[model samples]
Target chain A: MNTLMRWIGIAVVIFIAAPLVIVVPMSFSTAASLQFPPPGYSWGYYQQFFSDPSWLRPAWNSIYIATMNTLLTMALVVPATFALVRHKFWGKSFANLMMMMPMAVPHIVMAVGYYSYFGELKLVHSKLGVILAHSCLSVPITFLVLSANLKGFDLTLERAARSLGATPGQVFRHITLPILKPGLAISALFAFIQSFDETVVAIFISGRDAETLPRKMFDSIREEADPVIAVISTLLFAVVFAGLIAPSLIKGLRRMAGGTPSK
Target chain B: MSAYLRLAGVNKTFGNFTALGHIDLEVEKGEFVTFLGPSGSGKTTTLMVIAGFEKATRGEITVADQSLAHLAPQERNIGIVFQNYALFPHKTAAENVYFPLQMRKVGKKEGMKKAAEMLDLVGLKGFAHRLPKELSGGQQQRVALARALVFEPDLLLLDEPLGALDKNLREQMQIEIKRIQKRLGVTTIFVTHDQTEAMSMSDRIVVFSNGAIEQAAAPLDIYHRPATRFVADFIGESNLLEATITDAATGKAHSPVLGEVTCGAEGLPPLTDGQAVSLLIRPEHLKLSREPKEGRQNAQMVIETIVNYGDNAVVIGHAGDQQIRVRVPGADVVILKEGDSCHFSWTADAVFVLDK
Candidate 1:
């Protein structure tokens, strides 16, 4: 009876995730517009997404924005997280609340706010404008993730480094930065995803010159329900999905190779 | 010669909570001084303040006569070993030792060569390529010590450096650390709560309690002539009996447990003109006897309980309504089972006066 209930629970989860799984095969549709059951299987939309520079340019733009936003978020968040975790100071709680404030405010509202705010600054249709807009959303999540990671950090290691003749900067560089590798990598990847898959923020702040791929996909879906959007969506999902599974894959491979995972 | 390092009127506070209060200390070069205390007694906190991790709220700290108040930990040129060893998980054993030199920006080749030599000194030469996790806990600790010594700092601060090891490993590391510190001739300050560890390693011990220095002296002096009631209670096992000064200013007293006795101290209010005071007597100093205690060799009691702890026996006995313990040692020592009666007696000089 327990096994049957377990199977039923698993089936319910799969049923809830039906739409997401169904969208992947739609990218193979033979017809122009997206339809249920995909009409028939073909690589036409996929080829179109890669071949046409109109779609290609936004894809490249998305790549650039994601990379730059992730890097910028890391640069800002890592040190801030370090200070928040490693040092005691006044207004620390206030700083933490501000860092996590973005996660509380609805992104659509912030996008609207940023849209008007940047437009006043004459930054509405620029790459720097979108970069700044996306960064606002990305940096908070990056800081939150990295902060949680830093909580588990053995602060004694930094002290040990200092006692061994490491200046404050050297301790951060040698002891802190290297041990924070896993957290940094994970945060950067998630930060990239946070900006890459975001449609609402891109819709309000993105411009003709700085049109991100998600905004482009939104435009295509709004104008003429294109199957190519599904293709790009599936490709984006595949990239993120692979990232989520890579660590597990390596662990599984290690087990298969008869090597114990060393702490 | 003067002491190598000293903390004169060193005080520390975290807001209203006093962690260490007006601590005065000194340790000669090549001499190991252990700060012994219970948790929250400011032992590890004192070490951190010395290492510049925690700034003293007031007063001054000096290493070989140089003030260290404003100096950062790196600039103070002190080596520290934490309880956890704190080896960088990402680095190989050799790299861990080389980190200090690398931080000081020594050339890569020289740093690696010196780190290799340190690893060899720690008896971990062949394991240099292994990561910290790849080695045993004891080995990781050795690597940490080697790293701390890599820069050859003027002072070494150890915060319960052997605390994380098992009994056998801890003992082994204690000797290894002592040997290394001796060879290096660094003024070392060790902080630990374990009395046995302090007694085994330190040339002298500073006992702290309630944010103050309870006592500071050689191990034997601390054991024999503790300055306060707290020190005697902290350092070893003992029996404290309420007494009255029968002959004030003549080193004579009358303990309620065993009657009149001669001591080296008198003239305190609690023991004034036959007034009551506390006299602390070490359990081992009291011996078990079959005969009754008489004049000048007076003070006799009866055994209450005997605890056999493999190597020795602890016999707790009653003498005139007061309980006392006698540490009985021998291969064929008579083990007094619980509720079995026996006699107890000790010298008056073994009784210490606590005038409260």
Candidate 2:
């Protein structure tokens, strides 16, 4: 039974990691097109991805749109989460449902809706259109993260601050914002990742001028099987993996240096 | 001199549910008062109203002859130490203490120096840089105390600050808090349901029941001379026997369980003849003996349980249908046994009457 269970675990891990194993190696392949095995390893695709204006412009566009989406999403979600988590009023349940509506509906359906809706607003094929759509899509997960943090926040701290002579605005600046910094960072990261990786909505609204990286990758894959797509995937995976482990890596290095961790 | 902090007919209601019902209280300057009651009895609610968190539906609070009506909590200049400590996790001990001063726009260097001095006063001298989670529970409690006091606010309200600590640590912090409050001479209000904490710390204790103040007096007075049956029963372990005053002049009362009893304790309320009242006999005041003792109010009962502490023991038994508890010295426990018929006696001086 133990052997069978161990085998099952190994199979599950392999199935989950198969994409990374394939994409990472294919990224370094010297093949002219997307192919595996019999292809020699080189940095040719990585060089092309960095040097090509076609790849670089969309990458920069994705970054800009994602950054704007994050800012706009946080601006909308922060206060909404605080209200929904901390207060109750008429139609509160409906408001809560509306906040999570984007997550419930299919992404393709949302893409189609925005494609026409933004077209009428004369915003389609513009960076503003993609940013606005991504912000709406980012709301649910961002709200979930922020509301969970807000709920766990001991309100007594705010009360304590007030008693200690901090005005309402001062309390937020000195106590609430500082304490919620980590949660806010994580939620904003989620928003950025969601916008940067959103393909369907970007393909619909982000036309030639405002094309995001994911839409560009999709177009390129359909037109020609570009190995550069694998390079981009590999680079994004490395960046995200580094971000996830950076905190512990820094802590470990500090420990090795005989410096105390700041809890 | 006028009272330092005063609440005149303060009442709070949440829709239909009354949280505080016509609370009128006065605390002299530099005096330590405690609001003692069970959960939902509105002790904390009164504190919140005073702190401006829960606005009173009616009535007003004044400190130093100034009405706190239009003042926000920040303008009121009151310090509070919460039950959970509520220390800023991101700030060090010194920084936490410096927060109030920073709000007053004190410079960083000077505020930090003052904060360190305050931390030193709380016996956390060298822990200025430690985060709250890095310190022990008692240390966190001291940091909270220092932070609350560093601003030198007009009032300090501690909401059951020692409730989360272990017994030994709780006792230690109690003494520590009392010492700090004394040194600072801040008019402090500590809230707790723990009767012993209220008894040991407060210059005066305001006992709450339901939504009103049952009685407010010095600790011993509140304990020995509780104004109502609820105060008698809640403050300490007591055998509250239902009785009727038979002679108002002689302090005599008749009880179904203990028969005729004389309530001659000093400071007892004036009783009228045929008045329905309760005779409160604290368990420690009752003496357990094998035979009916002479010149004392004696009652016979069958011993059912003996709960032994290290230095003392409580002998619980029944007389007719009423349960009687008698606290005896640990040395006397060997002479008593369960199922043995025993006599519990109290003198006239120990028998206090509650006419409520």
Candidate 3:
């Protein structure tokens, strides 16, 4: 049973990791199209991906839109989470349901709704249209992450601060904000990823001027299987992998530095 | 001199549920008072009302003759050490202590220096740079104490601050807190359900039951002369016998278990003839003997159980239908056994009468 379980675990890991294995090497492949077991390996596609303005513009646009979506989502979600978690008022349950409504509805349905609504508003093909739509889609996940953090927060800390002569504003600034810094950062990261990876809404409202990276990738894959897509995918995976490991890496470096000074 | 901290007819209600019912209390400056009661009693609610965390719905609270009604909690200048310590996780011990000074607009350099000094006062001298999570529970308690006292606020309210500590540490923190409060001469109110903690620390204890003050007096007075049956039963171990005052003039009462009993005691409320009352005999005051001792009121009971506590033991037995507890020296317990008929004796001075 133990050996069988071990085999199953390894098989599951390999299955989950199959995409990275296929994508990373194919990114450097000398093949003409998106093909595995390539004829040869080179950095040719990586260079092309960096040099092409069409690919580059969408990459920058995705970054800009994701950043804006994160900011807007946090601005809406923070106060909403605090209210929903901490207070009692009329229609609170209704308000809570509305906050989580976008997560329940399908993204394709939302994309179709925004495509026409934004078109009538003369916002189609503009960066603001994509940003606004992504912000709405980002709200549920942002609120979920933030509200969980807010619930676990010891409210006695605020009362203690007040007793220590800090005003409500000062308590939030000095105690609540600093203590919740990590949770806020994680939730904002989730909002950014949601926007950056969102293809449906981006394809709908982001017609040409505001075409995002995911939409561009979708268009390129349909028209001509660009190996540059694999290069972009590999670069994104590296960026995310670096982000995931950065905290522990910093901690390890600090421990080494601290040990050296002590010795 | 007027009381430094006063709650006059303070009442708090959450919709229909009354939390604090007409509380009127006064504490002199530099006195350490404790609010002692079980959970859901008005002890912690009264503390919150005084700290401005919970507003008193009906009555006014004043500190130093200044009304606290118009002031927010920040403007009231009170310090609180919550039950959980409530230390800011992100801030180092020194930074946590410096926070109040920072809110007062003190420069960071001077504030941090003061914070370090305060930490030293709490016996956490070199722990200034460490975050709260790095410290042990007792050390975290000390840091919390330092943080609360760093600003020298008008009042310090501790809400069961040592309830989370282990037995040894809880006792140690109790002594430490009392010492710090004395050294600083801050008017402090500590809340706890632990009767021993209340007895060992407070200059005065206010006993609460069911949203009202049962009795507020010195610790020994509260133990020996509780004003009501609840206070008598709550403060310490007691054998509260149902009795009626037969003769108010001679201080005599009748108990079913002890037959006729002499009940005159100092500080007892005035009794009347035929007045229904409770006769309170403390467990420690009752002496257990093999035979009825001369010149002492005695009752025969069948010993049902003996709870030994190394130094002392409680002998629980029954006289008729009444369960009587007699605390005897642990060494004396060997002479007695369960199911043996023993005579428990008490003098009239040890029995106090409470009106039913």
Candidate 4:
């Protein structure tokens, strides 16, 4: 049974990793078009991706929009999550359901809705429009992460701080915010990545001035299958891999510095 | 002497449910008072009200003659060690203790030095750098105590601080806390449901029941003279007998099982003849023998059970439908057995009378 389970796990890993594995090799290929086994290997595509204005513009736009989306999303979701999780009021369950509504709807459906809705607001084709749209899309995941953290938080610590002579604002600064830093960081990271990789809504709303990287990549793949797309994919994959592993590396470093025996 | 802390008619009601009912108490400087009661008996609620976490619906609380009505919890200048200790998991012991000093604008070096000294007072001399999770329960409790007392606030409130410790460790912490409170001379209020803890660690105990104070008195006084039947039943083992006052002046009361008995008249309210009352006989005050004893109230009972505690044993028996308990030394249990009829007697001074 154990051997069978191990084989199943290996099969699952290969299934999930096969596409990613292909993207890295394709990024290093000299092919002019999509191919499984590249005709040859070269750094030509990487150079093209770096020097091209069309690609760089969207990459910069994505970074700018994602950063703004993260800030705005955190500003709105942090307090909303606190209110939803830490308080009892009428229509609370309904409010929680409403916060999660954007995530539940299909992205294509939201794209259609935003195409007309943002058009009416004259926010289409702008960085502000993409940021506003991405902030909406990122709220659910941010709220989920933050609410879970807030739920596990021992409120007695706040009370203890208050009893120890900290005002409410000071308690938040000294105790609540510091203790929740990791959760807040992870939640903000999720919001940034959510907006950076969101393609459907960006394709519908971000026309030329605020074309996000994902929308550019989507159009490139559909039109010409640009080899630069592979380079971008590989770089994105490397970033995700680092993000996944950084937490454990940090924990290990902290343990070594503390020098205390673990339980 | 002027009271250091005063809670005057403080009442708290959550919607329709009353959590504390007209709680009025005063504590002198450097006094350690324990609120003793069962769960949901308003002991913890009273502590919360004093800590300013729960606002009293109707009354005033004052410290050093200043009313605390408009003050927030932080403005009250109080320190509290919660039941679970509530130490910040991210902060080291020294940092946890240094927090209050830091808030008061103390410099990093001086605040941390004061924190280390407070840790030393709690007997955790070198544990300053360890995080709360790295410490054991007792160690964590010590860190919490050091943190609460380091600021030297006007009052210290401990809400069942030793509830998590083992028996031996709890006893040790009880003494440790008492010594620290005395050394600091901080007006302290400790809350616990453990009667023995209240007896051993408190200058006075306030017994709570159903959102009201049952009685507040010294430990021995509460044991010897409980103000109500609930107090009598809660504080210690007592065989309460329903009786009627035969003569108030002579302190005579008549019970079904033990006919006309003499009781202590000290502190008893004025009683009329034929008035219904409760006669309290503490188990330790009763003597057991095979025959009736001379110069004391005597009654015969059949032993129903014997609970031996090595040093002493509680022999439970019944007399004509009335249950009676007698506490005998362990050596004396050799001659007694279950189902055997025995005579139990108590002196007149041991019998306490309570009016219904």
Top candidate (TM-score) = 3
- Please give, for residues A1-263, the per-residue lDDT of candidate 2 as tens digits: 99999999999999999999999999999888899862699999999999999999999999999999999999999999989998988999999999999999999999999999998999999999999999999999999999999999999899888888899999999999999999999999999999999999998899999999999999999999899999999999999999999989998999889675454
iRMSD of all candidate structures: 2.7, 1.9, 3.2, 1.6
Tens digit of per-residue lDDT, candidate 3, span B183-261: 9999999999999999999999999998999999999999988899999999999999999888888898888889999
DockQ class, candidate 2? medium
Error of 4 at A73 (Å): 0.6
Task: Give the runs in model 4 whose Cα sits over 4 Å from its true position.
Answer: A1-15, A29-44, A254-263, B265-267, B334-336
Per-residue lDDT of A150 in model 1: 93
Pairs of colliding residues, candidate 2: none
Q: What share of the true interface contacts does each candidate keep?
A: 0.91, 0.87, 0.91, 0.91
lDDT of 1 by residue, B1-356 (tens): 99778888888888888888888888788888989999998888888888999998888888878999889988889988889888899999888888888877898899999999998888887888888888999999999889888889898888888888899999998899889888888778899999999989888999988878888889988888778878878889988777777777676777666677777542233346666667888987777766655632545566677778878888877777777777888542564566656566667667778764
Model 2 over residues B45-88: C-alpha lDDT tens digits? 99999999989999999999999999898889999999999999
- Candidate 3 residue pairs in backbone clash: none
Which tens-of-lDDT digit does each residue in A109-215 have in candidate 3?
99999989998999989999999999999999999999999999999999999988888998999989998999999999999999999999999999889999999
In model 1, state the lDDT of residue A197: 82
Give stretches of model 3 more than 4 Å off. A1-8, A259-263
The list of candidate 2 runs beyond 4 A from truth reads A1-11, A253-263
lDDT by residue for model 4 (A134-199), tens: 999999999999999999999999999999989999999989999999999999999999999899
DockQ of candidate 1 relative to the true structure: 0.54
Worst 10 residues of 2 chain A by lDDT: A254-263
* Worst 10-residue lDDT window, candidate 1 chain B: B264-273
Highest DockQ against the true fold, candidate = 2
